[model samples]
Target: MLIYAHRGASADFPELTMAAYEGAVEQGADGFECDLRITKDEVPILWHNASMLERAGNRGLIAEMTYKEVSRAYPQVLTLDTFLDYAIANKKGVLLETKHPVFSGNRVEELLVTALHEKKALAKIAVSVMSFSWLAVEKMRRLDSTINTTFLMHKNTPWFQARFSSSAAIGPGMNELRAEPMIAKKIQSLGRSLNVWTVDKDADIHLCQKLGVDILITNKPAHAREVLGYP
Candidate 1:
């Protein structure tokens, strides 16, 4: 299974920052995973929350602030463009998750497709889009059927929803999988890849490997590598 850095080695560095991504590369991760959000000016950035109060210590919502304003508040912030450039330079794969129900509606999907096409990312390295919102995944398919997509699943995600999804892969949280190991077999039975998320524990990492997971998204890439004996 491929080991992807969840928000770029986030256990060691700040999430969605360059330092974290650099740490991921240094730790020998197969790919970089990130959450994408657009600013007021329509610039795609790497961020995970609706409000900047946690990461930036400011009350500004990401959709309400321009890139400049965001930068002023949190200079360590990374943009999609910058992250893509670094990934391309390093020849590393990327998994982009677009946050849904945002103030910008479906603009994030449009901008993401535009950026991927502009960068010709598919021609260079592996790129996949994942989202918890089924509608967002549907919109992504409408925008670009060629792009690979994974429908993220939580505990409450309907099983039928996953069964009917057109995504190439099904991303389930590690907790969900631990509770129901049959999910792996069921997903594989449908000929869809299984990508588990935020897996940090050694036993869970081993379980993922044993279950034949396609991609393992984790906060500690180095630790996962060690646990899986990847080196």
Candidate 2:
């Protein structure tokens, strides 16, 4: 199974920062995962939450602030362009999670596709777009069918099998997989690869292995590599 650093070795370094992503690469992670949100200037940035108050102590929605304003408030924040450049340079795979409540219609999808095309990084590194919103998945597919898409599922989500038929993979929460081990097989039976998220425990790692998950997304990439017997 591929081990992707969730938020780039988030357990060891600040989440979504360049430090965190570089740390993951240093630790020998196969790939990295990041959450994305668009700024007021239509720039896609790496950030998990809608507000920057918790991480940067700035009190404003990311969508309400321009890239320049956000950079001034939080210099650590990384733009999607910067992150993609790093991933392409390092030849690392990236799982980009598009945060919901997007304020800019299809602008986020447009910008991301345009960036990938501009950099010509599509063939250089592996990239997958994942989201809780099925619309986001559809939008991404419409923009670039070649780019892989994953449908992210939480506990109470309804049956999404038909809704995400075009997705190349299915990302279920680790806890959700634990509750229904058969879900993994079910997803695989549909010919979709399984990518489980935020798994940190040894038992969970073993469970994912037994279920034959294609990718394991975790905050502790180095530790997970050790557990998985990877050097």
lDDT of each: 0.94, 0.90
At residue 82, candidate 1 shows an lDDT of 93
- lDDT, residue 148, candidate 1: 96
What clash count does candidate 1 reach?
Answer: 0
lDDT (tens digit, per residue) of candidate 2 on 53-74: 9999998999999999999999
- Backbone clashes, each candidate: 0, 0
Best by lDDT: 1
Q: Global CA lDDT of candidate 1, please?
A: 0.94
For 40-83, candidate 1 gives per-residue lDDT tens digits of: 99999999998899997899999999999999999999989999
Clashing pairs in 1: none
